[model samples]
Target chain A: MEASTSRLERDYRRVLRLLPAGYRRQWGDDMVGALLDAEQSAAAASAADEGPERQAEERDIALLQRPPLREVAGVAALAVRLHLASPSTAGATAAARLRGDAVRRVALVGLLAAAGPALLSAVTGLYWPVPPELEALGHTRVDALASALLALVAVAAFALFVTGRHRTASVLAVFAVVPDLRHPLETLASAWRVSPGTLLGAACWLLVLLAPLVALLAWRSDAPRPSRRWLLALPVVAALGWVPWLLWRATGALVAPDAAGSLALGAAACAVVALRRSDASWMRTAAVLAAVGGLGSLGQLSLLGYPPGLERDLGWTALGTVLLAAAVGVVAGVTGRRWSAQAAPTAVTAPDRSASDASA
Target chain B: MALTEPAVLVLTALVGETRHGYALIAGVEELSEGRTRLSVGTLYGLLDRLSSEGLIALDREERHQGRTRRYYRLTDDGAAALEAEAQRLAHLARAASARLRTARAV
Candidate 1:
């Protein structure tokens, strides 16, 4: 009986660890003690009617059946109750919430809406030839110049739309990605021998239809006051993802390059965005490493087939390398800054408690 | 068969009379011959679930032995459930005993 009581006490004590750190610090031991005392009293009363030896064996069996410490359901229920019971820790930022909701809704709708028309135009075989005046000037050069200009415009529109509530800019950004999205559908249709133009058109129509809904959500939302630096990181990350894709389009035929670098850069940029939004250091670090490795490999490969005696290719390679390195440094610095901001105060609070204890 | 040990004991404890939290805990402990003892939190959590399911109803609130307590009484559904479970267990025990006797004779 005594042995079983001791085992039950140990089990209960272990379970008490699931309580919040603050709650455990205050009342864990007391709760465990109360549970043990109750168990002991119950055992004593039960022992009165049973044979002494049988009672001891029964107690042993009962102790063996003690529940495990990690009760997932219990902890989940407690966590939900705690969260609902507590007031919003982010404080009175209803305006910020509204703004954030608006931006998120706009981005979601724009992305969903653009998916269709882009695919349709691609499928319908709408070949966008270089303008006649530009064609007379030089077909390849004019095409490249047109593409570069469109890329710049798209990037600018995306930046403006993300940074401020400019409805026109947002709409333009949505249209800008339309051409790019259509390119994939066109290729798919040509290969599969099926018409995907209607599907693409429908998708674009849906996006256009949903524009008002996105705008309304954005307008109605209380603008969330996330750190401006963190907010700025979003566009930077998006631009980083865009650069490799643009580069691929420009140099894909000439370079016949592996897509490994672009994938690495995109993943790294996503990690930076995620790190800024959440407290995940490992993912941020992984993103940085993947970006660096991918860019370094691509830069190395780009230099391999350079024309003899023309160091110009080397210069471009060096420039690309430098840009990639700069991106890694920027993302790491942001991640470090965010981590330190959250970590420093928690470190300082520990020593003050010991000093107070000594004084008491 | 689905009734948890705690739920069954709780229902058995309230078989004849309504009981509050502290009394229910005590009664369950006594009825189980102290084989199963539930903490106050566990008891309350189970009671809340049972009440929500309509198997048990809050009967009354009164001061008992200096502590305010809310008494719970099993519904007809709960009693019927307990009876069904008891019969199932009894049937299983009888079958097992018969099997053991047959094995010993063989």
Candidate 2:
């Protein structure tokens, strides 16, 4: 009987891994132990009515047969709810709770505001450029008008930033830059001297272009005070002081074997320093973008000007795509973690009327 | 009349009396002819959602047969909703069967 219980416990443990990491982290082991104990006790109680211990073993065996997947899913869901509502498990600071609410509201507003230009351009048919040689240039006029729309988005973003509407500012910043994704390779080549086929360039683009919006959205909305780490922006401002000199040096050494490479390395180092001094939310956002951009740059470089026999262009493309996918996944994971953290405090503080009513 | 499958099963199980977490799950399975069984997590998640919506209220907690159980009862609204849903389903089934018989005759 004990052996059968042990076997059932083992099977159940394997199924528990299907749960989310956070849920498993808090309750996985304890739940497994409790279920196993319950099974063993049930077996023991039924053992007396059976003719032999083998009959009790048979009953335990029947119970151990695979439970339906639906049952398991249901149990997992209940576990998550119980854990969420359990005050002892939530462990959220008051500041974090308030900040979380503020962040959600701010993020929603930013997302809505950022959609403005894109929505307007789509509606007015003014932003979609047509080929220059097209017979009917009137339709193409809309495409040319798109630049004005983009400019408006950029201006709105800058205004938001200046006015301390950071969330909306960040969203606008992203909206302003999204058109660049259409020609990511060209953008990298022109701005950073990195090829689109290389991992480093891709990483750089992601870090510099995509991460800030994600970070701003993730920032706690109701944090009682501004992050002290905002002070780090001063250092970033100072680092820009050396950009002109570095640019001059690079121009002089353009003929050097690794001059472009050195520039990439230097930019990455500066980004790291800037990130370290920023708020925790921004730091993570910047780090992810930088990492993606840097990798992309490298991938692009590896594919450029390759000798016919020596170069593998497809391999480089695959590498760049994988790196981009990974960076996106990392950003998504970070977003999810932020949301769960925000939700935790609310779940904990809310009354567990079900439990209380059951007791009464 | 728009109750989800899980909610319907839960209310059905609680039609006559209140039952705690494990018992409610077992009762649901039995009532469904073992077609619907809920895991602990899913059961609790639904329970929380149902309780929050005021469809089901927690009744009491006590040690029964050496195991602690939390009992729940269907609220008046919940019972009414369940009955309406059942009626709707029955009406649909009857209409479908009549259509099938007509088609068979043709």
Candidate 3:
């Protein structure tokens, strides 16, 4: 019985080490004592319910039991919360807040970028003039209907996300990506025989669709609600594309906006936000935006090496702008980190009002 | 700030007396009618947050069965917060019951 108890205590202590070093230092022994106490009480209750012959045997087995999975999961959740929360010094707290802000903006910008093209496409399909030959196809109506519905779903997801209904928005955003996944899924399925260019194109396209969804994970219960002003960007971007498309249709003198162009516009928006804000957090956000845009640009590479035309020119231009933006973002992020580190000591001596008000 | 369910139960447990971690856990379980079982990790996290917010404070520590048990008590702030939360819940509960009774009569 003594040996079993010691083993159980040792195992519990091992799991407790998952917490932050400072936290473990303060609360480790107390937590271990509580766990043991709970175990003992639980064993006693179970023993009371058992017959005399079974009680002693049950007690011995219970003493030797390891920490339950739920307890371990609870500890892990606490560890993640503390590490992410980081209530160390005022400077550290500010840096954490900045990172949170950047992530939230990235999510908003990515979703807005996605929604722009989708809404444009849906509008074009449902309301734009179609050629007689194209209109004659029996399946065109069905395809247009499906496309419009998908676009509406995408817009709804973005709307919900900005309005603070994140859980539902996330689900809808994932649902919105199902159609986009088909081409990539097909490409991946034929991995054994697919060409490198096609495979890379599919993978990059998948990343473009996925980036916003991944960024949306930052919108935890504690995150501040996004402003509704961002919704205005969607209509503006959609209208910007219509001018070029209308010119192309009427005069054949202008290039119509494509997916790559939309991505470039999104990257430019991210760069603008990054440049406008002189803070380290915004710089880091710019870096994340650059990465997402870079993937979209790189995907455009598949359009190159096949023909010497507008597609190739557009690809090269997209790739260049993304690279330039990425370089600026990365340099700014590094400089911001150093500045935050230098300011940390001064911040340590000050009170952390933000820390006290941090969401539990 | 609105109290979370666990925070409310912990504050309720510490009401009128100081209690150790195990006692708080047991008290929470009993108060919740075995519906909510707080793990030690979660309890400590809440305690840490509450202590920082001035809602609770460390009362004392004692050696019991070769283990050091730290007892915590609700502060004035904590009691006030609990009272406010209780009133809010009671108001909602009363509204719910009144509606239910009206529905049954109809």
Number of clashing residue pairs, candidate 1: 18
Candidate 2 CAPRI classification by DockQ: incorrect
| RMSD (Å) of each candidate, 1 decimal | 19.8, 13.6, 5.4
Candidate 2 chain A: minimum summed lDDT over ten consecutive residues — where? A253-262
Per-residue CA lDDT of candidate 2, range A336-357, in tens?
3564465453333323545433
Winner on TM-score between 2 and 3 is: 3
- Model 1, which residues run further than 4 Å from truth? A1-360, B65-67
Point out the higher-scoring one by DockQ: 1 or 3.
Answer: 3
Better of 1 and 3 by TM-score: 3
- Number of clashes in model 2? 57
Please provide, for model 1 over A1-360, each residue's C-alpha lDDT reduced to its tens digit, 9 standing for 90 to 100: 134355665676566565445434433443444343345445555786778886666555545445434333443343223222211211112222322342343343233223222232232223464556856777665455555556555445444544554466556665675665564455545645644543443343333333323433333112332233433544444444444457658865222112223323443554555576664333343344444334434334334356743344443544454456456656656675676456442211001111211112
Candidate 1 at residue A314, lDDT? 45
Which has the better DockQ: candidate 2, or candidate 3?
3
TM-score of 2: 0.42
Number of clashing pairs per prediction, in order: 18, 57, 0
